[model samples]
Target: MDTADAIIVGAGHNGLVAANLLADAGWDVLVLEATPHAGGAVRSGHVTAPGYLSDLFSAFYPLGYASPVIKRLGLGEHGLSWRHAPDVLCHLLPDGRSVTMNRDIEVTAASVEEFAPGDGERWKNAYRDWQDVATPMLDVITSPFPPVRAGLGLAARLRVSGGLRLARRLLLSARELGSELFRGEGAKLLLAGNALHTDLSPEEAGGAVYGWLLAMLGQQAGWPVPVGGAQRLTDALVSRLVSRGGRIVYGVRAERVLVARGRAMGVRSAGGTDWRARRAVLADVPAPSLYLDLVGARHLPPRLVEDLAHFRWDGSTIKIDWALSGPVPWKNPAVGRAGTVHLGADLNGLTRYAAELACGELPTEPFLLAGQMTTADPSRSPDGTESLWAYSHLPFRTAWDAEPVARQAERMEDVLERAAPGFRQLVVARHVAGPADLEREDPSLVGGTVGGGSQAAFQQLFLRPIPGLGRADTPVDRLFLAGSSAHPGGGVHGAPGANAARAAIARDRALTGDLYASAIRAAHRAVYADR
Candidate 1:
């Protein structure tokens, strides 16, 4: 049997991040990946054409660029370079008008002003408020739940910014926030469209939180792509881990977590290989998979098993990638400046799409979130050509039969054509992945949910993955949830992984190990005391 100080299941970015941190702290770390490659959803491949690079799942990582966790990893030294498009984003309206966001505050303000008379100043004001709280706010977000110190800093800043009023605003639906702040459809579409990036609708409560966070991050740190390919980011992480003497095994699926008397011992692979862990087992898979599939129902608290039964997955996803003959011929030239684009005619269209999903109906017209990879990173394809991909969310139970999915992809292409004339003509090659395909490619996506689980307020913070302490510690001792299913949810940022690593390290300290473990166990008992 192989052994290590820490065994991380899944070589997804989060798992890799945890491995690197553990190794850096002088713990022997081992990573197990079911796939042959490392980058779970963050991979890139020439699926469209030999010369075109398409991100397998996620692209344009604004969260990663703004993440102090990722920043502190010093991935740049390990060959990670970021590339940003000239303009940050664009939302194409039904009337062919483009609302673009630029890194330059004035430019973004001017762009919004074209829609409403005073929206320019409103945009500036919003940006100013974001700047004031960006530091502490991000700290609180990326920290463990209950972020006492960071929350204090943010609370102080918020008092000066808008106090409890601002807190209420953050909890507003994207529609409400937009309507209250900007008297224009353009800015509203921008915010609502960003909200759709998650499995959220414009009218969903707390949708404004995601929309505003991404929008502000885009303004502060332009949505960036790895220069060569999304794979480069993974390579950088793997490089850093290997440099620190971490070992990763490919094609190894962790089938069961070996627990002894309520403590995690290690994991047993599908091939019947038992790998021991001296200290901890950090699972970067989804929450249910860890608690149900790996650990088994018998090992978990009855309440936790019941909670798993009620676990709500986010919506399914359908993604299409195209290798274009040339740049997208947007009817409006300003749309081409952006690396990322949102397609929803207006706030009503967004509402309609979300409503359809809620009713378990496949939308005839979907709201798309797309990325022009070549525009963001020129090296993605041949000069003058584009590597483009778009994805839309649907009901979780949507059937993904090949023919229907093909038809849906056609609908997406139709949406694109409406925004850019002759879009079909520019497609040199295309690839489509429906729910089944996405899940097959990355099981962590579970039913094609890219955000781990639902980002709804009920499933967030302390209630995340069940109503627990919201740290990485699991009911099974020495086990941690180091994936997006934990607090702070999903994105390219490695907060969940970083938090888990810190927790494991703190609990394993030579002088305080027993004390920390005792406290964590007591907290878990308090949370899981009931039936």
Candidate 2:
């Protein structure tokens, strides 16, 4: 039996962040990862030819760079350097036009003016409104729910009517917001395409918030990539955790959490190895995996178990990575300057794509979120050659056998070819990952559903990952879920893990912790009393 003050399952970036923070506070921490390597989805590898670094899953990190946890950890000091493209993102329109989102607000606004003359000023005004509330908004999203401080600060800034207006805007779908705000396709595509980054469609309520937040964040922080590769970010995080006296055990699958007297004691691996925790156990796996699989339905309230049955998962995805012989020969040369590009979709096209997904039908024209690694970081590949990666959402529960996956990859290439005429010719070698492959690589991305689960309005805020208060504390005492499935769901931001650590630390400390625990218990009872 192994023993530690705390045991963390999953060595993903979020788990690593939690371990670092906990170990820094003098708790002995042990992280068990099922994969041989850390970083989970935030991994970089050479899937194609030599001298080519491909981000196996997630690539660009706008949320990572903007994350408060990352800022506090100062990953830059631990050998993580960021590289930004000349432009943050480019949305290539079907009609041979494009809109680029630059780091500078004025520059981005100017690009919006290309489609509709006065809409440039509208873009500027919308961004200004975002700026006024950006700090508080980020605070609310990243903090533990019932965000008292963030709520108070935002209220102080917005007052009553402004807050109400903000709430109304949050309720709007991406399509609605775009139609209401801009008359041209450029700005509309920019917002709608970003919304598709998640599983949400243009028409889904609460999709507008994602579009607005991502676009504004791009303006604030130009969707930067790690200097070497996505692995560099993970390397820095692991380095920091090791420096802080935390140990990570690789290739250990946690089969079940060891519980005693309704309290989490630690975890037992599939090999029947027991790693005991003197204080707490933090699970960085998905909500379903943590609660229903490892912890088991027997321990949870009956109602919570029933709710888990209906827990919605985001759409699966098919990703394609290529080792290009040269840069993508975009018809619009300016598209080459962007780190990220949206391909084969305008506003209406994205809506139709979403509709197809809703009907569980493969889209005829899938929208692609493509990344040009060399454009952002020249060292990602050999000079003049580009490392390109793109992914499009698939219908949930789609059959992802090899043949189907290959067909989707080919379709994705077709979309890219249409956007950049010579795209197919430039591909020296390619790698494709279907939903099944993704699940095999990272179990957290169950069914290839990213962002934990769906970030739809019903699954957001306090209602995320099975209701109750929007905190990291789980139904069982001394156990916490610190994954993307928790509040402030998804993205590379380590808020969920950080929040779990904070809650655990608060409970371990005396005085105020007692009152805090009491309140949490009361809230939990109230939420699940009937069950």
Candidate 3:
């Protein structure tokens, strides 16, 4: 038998979560991380100043607050505490005005009413309808994929009257849905900006659902930040995993997955050590790197190889952090108290920003997603100062010079100056992490495409990475896609890793001994044949 029951490649948050579950259930688990740290996008460090802790990647997590998995893990006991700002999200408009949404429904409705007279009633009506359908959808969507039983349960739900109405909207663009819901441009811009959180355009298919989901979540739970920093969340996860007998080895990268008899056995580290597994091998790495570069097509089905070829990554983003002398002190004071501040006035601003990014031109006036991260948590910096971080999505893999970050910062200033004049005066020190810095941190980010493969309509759900299969089960029998590229896809949710773990458990429990050979043969036929 192998050294452990399972070998997890990449000690990212998702892999750690899966390892924790398996280990807690009495499986011996070993985690190998390419980087020297445990957290991937969840990393937090002092990049700006010595005492000031800056989030290296993802900072605020609304998902963290809402995820059942995190709650089940007892993360709060393990050092995960949340700090929420006054408002959920703030949109700093270019017309020298701003709108802030609160966690309470009536308060949020009133905030929107400033822009549209009776739109508050319309907003409430939309939310009322959304609530009827969202609770059930949230239950299933966020839950781990159940086998055939779960599928039928969801199918039954969709057959119901309320679910059918929601499903119809899922097929529409956020632009269409927002336009139908509100008469004011302010409300439309808010919905549109929220939809593009994954960097999907407002006009893109399947974008509406994200807007609806996030808006609902924002209403339900204002986005929250971890008390100590995001690293505390990682530390808690790692602690829980280790407490369950899962071992994590830092600074180890998987060079290739070990395949035998058409089944994944384990992985070969770049350091030239071979580790074997008795039950499963879960990879939290990106799709192309895991399938093409590391494992190669010899061990993969031909159609899967083609699907890997066609996999699309959500564009790159530039992450910037600052150790400010004081709070943002925005000209519009309301936005300063928000955890997340979206900066873009009207539809034209966003469309122009998208056009410039598409045409290989970083906008002269960029749209920024700014977060007053430290204001939410006092421990992030000194008592008087506030820590700030922001990122702007860009076209994927755009080739640029060594100091493109400096240019991007110049444009970022334009966004900040519009809402918070003299923003530069507030900066004590700044740290910039662009595409190159991102790739350097983790090759899986792949030019700062943090969502793994794109969340675009064609690359999502069952169609993600490939059609006919979306639940982490790859064409290779025991091999599975545990990264965000898999089903229920990206974000810091850890669903993909959890899905892969459950899939592995099911496959192992069923077929009694190695089902690798039989499963691969069947997968080959299904993939090659037309759906």
Pairing residues by index, what is the TM-score of model 3?
Answer: 0.95
Q: Least accurate stretch of 10 residues (summed lDDT) in model 3?
A: 143-152
- Count of steric clashes across candidates, in order: 0, 0, 0
RMSD of candidate 1 to true structure, Å: 1.4
Q: Which model, 1 or 3, shows the larger TM-score?
A: 1
lDDT of 3 by residue, 164-270 (tens): 67677887787888888998766776677787788677777788888888877787787888888889989999988877778988888889888887778888988
The per-model lDDT (C-alpha) reads: 0.89, 0.90, 0.78
lDDT of 2: 0.90
TM-score of each: 0.98, 0.98, 0.95
List residue ranges in candidate 1 displaced over 4 A: 510-512
Q: Residues 1-531, candidate 2, lDDT per residue (tens digit)?
A: 999999999999889989988988899999999989999999999998889899999998888898878889988889999989999999998787999899988888889998998988999888889899988888888889989998999999999999999999999999999999998888888888998999999999999999988998998888999999999999999999998889999999999998877689999999799999998999999998998899998887777788888888899999988999999988889899999999887788898999999999888888899999999999999999999999999888834667767887888998888888998988899988899889899988888888898999999889988777878998788899999999989899899989999888988885775576567666777887663
The segments of candidate 2 whose C-alpha lies over 4 angstroms from its true place after superposition are: 512-519
Per residue, candidate 1 scores C-alpha lDDT tens digits across 217-287 of 99888898998988999999999999999999999999999999888999999979999999999999999
